[model samples]
Target: MTKRNTKAKQLILNLLKAAKSALSQDILQAQLGDAVDRVTIYRVLNSFLEDGVVHKIVGDDGKQYFACCKNCSDKKYQHNHFHFRCISCGKIECLPNEVEVKLPKAYRTLNFNGVVSGYCSNC
Candidate 1:
């Protein structure tokens, strides 16, 4: 993997670290001020995603939101945490549950990927 140094990546990471909720590409670009172009920010996000430095989740609006990894140290990209999508506010919140998911024996026969999302308590 080629390492590239760009302000956009740094800014994006910082924003993700600071944000409490999921962020879309538009919001990230707005928060980045004038430090990076829209295309550059998107590219940076994609690169980080490919490097396993970040994870993307799909919202109810059919838009992808990026969030920092829960197990960033180990570089695990599994969606072990449940996603809470506020029906009223349309915000995707990450619930604070450090649980690991184990698939059933039946699922082992077939390759299974798990994802959990629903209306949050705040809704």
Candidate 2:
């Protein structure tokens, strides 16, 4: 299904595109202020996820974070990269390198979400 280009969606997309690291819903809500409602933001985020415009990452703190997808589509999602979380700053970022894991002969890999937590370079 085709989704409309609403102002709230555009704002959320712009914020995700401009973010250097993955952002949580709370963070996005705080950044958006009174312009967008929480329910609207949740709906837009779900739409983005369905459209493959963004990918979700689980933070070390157990919070769900969203980041812009570089090479993803509605059918296929190529997210073999690892996510890094800064212990000092509590920031989550998707690393550029693709992760390669060798599985057993009969094992088939589906979705992978690897998180590495440590002090970021800035810390």
Candidate 3:
């Protein structure tokens, strides 16, 4: 029972890789119906997070979004990326981890989340 043999996991990984943006469990379940149970999707996502195969972030809407982590390993995401949330369609995209935003000294920062909201190119 090696993890590599799990069909559901492979399906999820492929789905995330093909996605242009992060995906929620709701959306994942919709894309993969009868083949994989809804509960399995959630479990696989959790496992991926723990295994550092994918990264999860809480969106501005307070919902969890999962995206594949090609740049992550050993339980840490080596790159820092931003989330572009489209206000028009409510679609959130994971941008490349290259943009750096300097925070002002006056603002005490605890956690940094670069989530910018605006209309996407498709909109």
lDDT of 1 by residue, 9-108 (tens): 7888999888888888989888877888889878888887777777787776677788877667655445556666676766776777755657776663
* Number of the predicted model whose lDDT against the real structure is largest: 2
Q: Give lDDT tens digits, candidate 2, residues 1-123.
A: 666899999999999999999998999999999999999999999888778899889877898899999867545756788999999998899998997888889997767888999999999
- After superposition, the stretches of candidate 1 with alpha carbons farther than 4 Å from their true spots are 98-123
Error of 2 at 64 (Å): 0.4
What TM-score goes with each of the models?
0.73, 0.88, 0.78
Top candidate when judged by TM-score against the true structure:
2
Clashing pairs in 1: none
**Candidate 2 local lDDT, residue 3:** 67
Clash count list over all predictions: 0, 0, 0
Please state the error at residue 101 of candidate 3 in Å. Answer: 9.1
lDDT of 3 by residue, 1-123 (tens): 556649998999899999988899988989998889988999999998778777876788888888888756555334367888888887887786665557787864444466888889989
Q: Which runs in model 3 stand beyond 4 Å of their true positions?
A: 1-4, 98-112
**Candidate number with the higher TM-score (2 or 3):** 2
Alpha-carbon local distance difference test for all models? 0.72, 0.89, 0.80
Tell how far residue 49 is off in model 3, in angstroms: 0.7
